[model samples]
Target: MGSTIFTPFSQKELIPKEEKLEIYRRERKLCIGIPKEISIDENRLCLTPDAVQVLVNAGHRVIMERGAGEGSFFTDLQYSEAGAEILENRKDVFAQSLIIKINPPTLEEIEWLQPNAYLISALQINLCSKEYFKKLSDKKINAIAFEYIMDEYKQFSLVRLIGEIAGTISILYASEILAQTNGQMLGGITGVRPTEVVVLGAGIIGEYATKAAIGLGASVKVFDNSIFKLRRLHTIVDNRVPTSIIDPKELKKSLRRADVVIGALPRINQLPIITEDMVSTMKKSSVIIDLTVDSGKCVETSELTTLSNPTVIKNGIVHCGIPNLTSKMSRTTTKAISNFFLSYLLEIDQEGGFENQLVKCQEMKQSLYMYKGRLTKCTIADKFGMQYHDINLLIF
Candidate 1:
């Protein structure tokens, strides 16, 4: 029979067999926005003038609102010289293709953003409300929380840098506070014994706090719930500082003798490690700098305060719980943030912009809470009782 006598599946050879490849997207020229921080305490700028110069040199336009860098002491002239366009109206900055900020945008600022604008900023979840997430989602913004963004090492790079600054600043701040409160020095003298510093938690903040305190010639001890963290810290500090697994009794005992307490623990909704009673047990006129207060109060007595009115006296102990405490050195923090951000934004550009970045970079998805009006972060979804969408499913 002539069945199957057809010539090699009929016109199969006529069909073009060239292997199809993905359409290569050229690098994007992202327009970056830098708005003036609305809140006074949010003194850090996302990009320094040098970063602006880098982005501009890479064929991108930078738009900064007038006085955006005043807090960081980076003048508009500097940005202008760096090839940034200074806009008189702040809303104009938010209208750009990309927005990089130290603080999350205010509701008004969010509304000002063009739909689908890429936002890179701190989430500061504790400070956000359900409505805040809703506003971002409603805007259909592509937002990434810089706080949760991880580096190649799977570490929160931005948070660690800021934490490092916060830790060192915590000790320095305590020194000034101690002198004012009781005329006591922070470090040891030749004859006098070394001043005591009690550091809570053993994360990046706690570790840096320990190092700074030790450097200042203070007798130091660290306490944390995790034995692993404590042990790691012990090794990191060369055992110069004693480490404990947060024995309540021992903590209370140490607090009594502690001249400075640096609360570096990452506490959220959970009850603080140091209760009010524990704080009360500390010596009078002792200084407590709660570095983690932005997330939650590490010391029960510590209340979130502004930079202008930073310290509060309660139980005869001076407490400072200023969020963005590292912003006290606005210039330094700005520079560090700028360095991190310069690389991050350029990577996004090299990847062909944010959407392509989402498709390719898993680490970027880790920090994304919202994508095109969908809730992508489980933590934010759970907190707000909103529907959670896995970013992976939505993107790919």
Candidate 2:
């Protein structure tokens, strides 16, 4: 050993003791709380084997509740082989790590959640009760809602890539309902030569409905409050689809010519856009597909209908307002959802970790609600009558 030790130019620095300790504490693990009580039809598996494989490759541990995938035809052995740990009880999974779920956490399930655990799920929070929010606040749980978050374009963030799939299939769903009705085919030559199709709220669902209608050779007219979105749709469709900025008066006039009306409006806490008078104006033999019926309907005649009994004649117009339209086409919906999950996981993996990557991404940041136990989503806070804190302040 030389007594003359080497002296460095100071390009390399040692990590702080605290920083190294923090790195050691950061582990990759997640728990998936699936409702064993809820029967997963063969069509809808929350996390497919392919998705599990991606997660496994990312070096994250997945803990799943027993029988969680039973409805989806995925046995415990299948998930185990895919590198997921199978836990016997739902509470154990909830208590362990970050949770990813297809449905909203139930009251009982939320009770099992560990404090400060992260959850990724659908926009079922809105459907949750005041009690649920109280529990959420008490537990210091952080959540990312898949539905309300927006991408760069301010569209349905989670549903954007999958919207066309959901939208296109909605037409098939509506068609199935329409087929059961006494009304004639959409593009019949004789009576009602060009079936007058009215698609309200020219968003993704409306655009796809327009496409489906056009494909079926039916005349399509799209109504929207946003002239901007309507114009965008016009450009995308090459002006082939006619769009109208909805005037309440004009809406009445248009309904008279409509053979099939599709409501694709976003949720608003107000009276239905289509009043009984508007429904009365529609042709007696016409059909109404209320896509927005999930968040309270746009059509006055619309009522909640299940896939089992999907249609009812209200005010002499056939109405269909099934909540889970995509579920009707489960194969495509599940595959699309699986692809999204894979893409989301890969995006996180590429950036090192979900917290570091997601919190830094501006689009994801906008969707973030709480960071390090501080309120970050102002809109949600305002909606829920809670105090808002700037995300930057919370993170720092």
Candidate 3:
């Protein structure tokens, strides 16, 4: 009765209310490392001198191992002039907070990495063994594949760019190989029949390959398992190119008359679309360029080869399965890669810090294959027979 008679307490006094707001963290300066690629066929560099300059201007430290940019034709002096420290010992470079390179680090290179360092590189899963993942996990490193990195639009930006380059380069390489193999031209001449190019798959690589082949006056035909992709490719190419479903019989017939066959199919299963028998039926001395060799080739005869020893003659056909075809234009690819990395790193820095960015950025989350010591990608885990953990669980 006395309590009921007392005056009611104010809401502030009852609840002890206090104003609170989210904290905005200060931007962090990163220490980025660029190591020289030891892989003979890897010619592209992840970051350019101009990109280093931009990072340096933002107060980040960039460490370049001596000759890190040599493959891409960017001199050490260029990187130095742009405010990067050129270290003689590569291990010292790997000690940086982040390491960015064109190729994934070898086991020896991984040994030099500091614990929990951020690794940005291509995860050529075809080349990696289970032991590779174990080593990276043991080090508790965070690995993000540039190839797997998605943009705001959900498109794989670097992968598509590289595919575009590889597509064009595939046709160019076919032209050279055709001339050297049998002295045949790639395009049609006046009053002469046009060279026929059969492109497998209707992805980015296939579309660009068709464009390049068509531009050179070659009649191009595309085949894909997906009718939507075939239609998309037809529309993308202005509906000028012929498209077909991947009918084994039709493909065999086309290959028999094809002057150049470009395999651009994404890996569906473990096997190639074109059997050895199919390859045998192709015109003698014609070229086959498999742009998807990194994933798994679409041509049975194609083997992964380096740039130095690219083409292999088999079944009287020139088979070129050099996966990193864009590496031939190292400087252009380096610039393109650098453009992506500069923007990405800048965004990370602007977001305050790596952990802060991780908390707020979906793109970075999508890019990371590993977080801390756990495998965050199901594909990698399945490939290696390792347990998978969702990256969201690891971070948040």
Candidate 2 has its poorest 10 consecutive residues by lDDT at 18-27
Flag the better candidate by TM-score, 2 or 3.
3
Q: Count the clashes in each prediction.
A: 0, 1, 0
Would you estimate the TM-scores of all the predictions?
0.94, 0.83, 0.94
Predicted candidate 2 versus true structure: per-residue lDDT over 7-32, tens digit per residue: 66443554344443333223354444
Q: Which sections of candidate 1 miss by over 4 Å? A: 1-19
lDDT (10s digit) by residue, model 1, range 279-363: 8888899998887777777788888888899899999989988888888899999999899989988888888887787778788
RMSD (Cα, Å) for all candidates, in order, is 2.7, 5.5, 2.6
Which wins on lDDT, candidate 1 or candidate 2? 1
Off by over 4 Å in 3: 1-18
Candidate 3 lDDT tens digits, 1-396: 455546577756777667898986875589999998888788889899999999999899999999988888999999999999999998899889899888889998889888998999998787788999999999999999976799889999988988888889889999998899888899989999999999998888888998999899999989998999987876778646888898999999999999999999856337889999999988899899887777767888888888899899999998888878899999998998899889988988887877888888788788999888789989888877999999888787
Query: Largest lDDT belongs to which candidate?
Result: 3
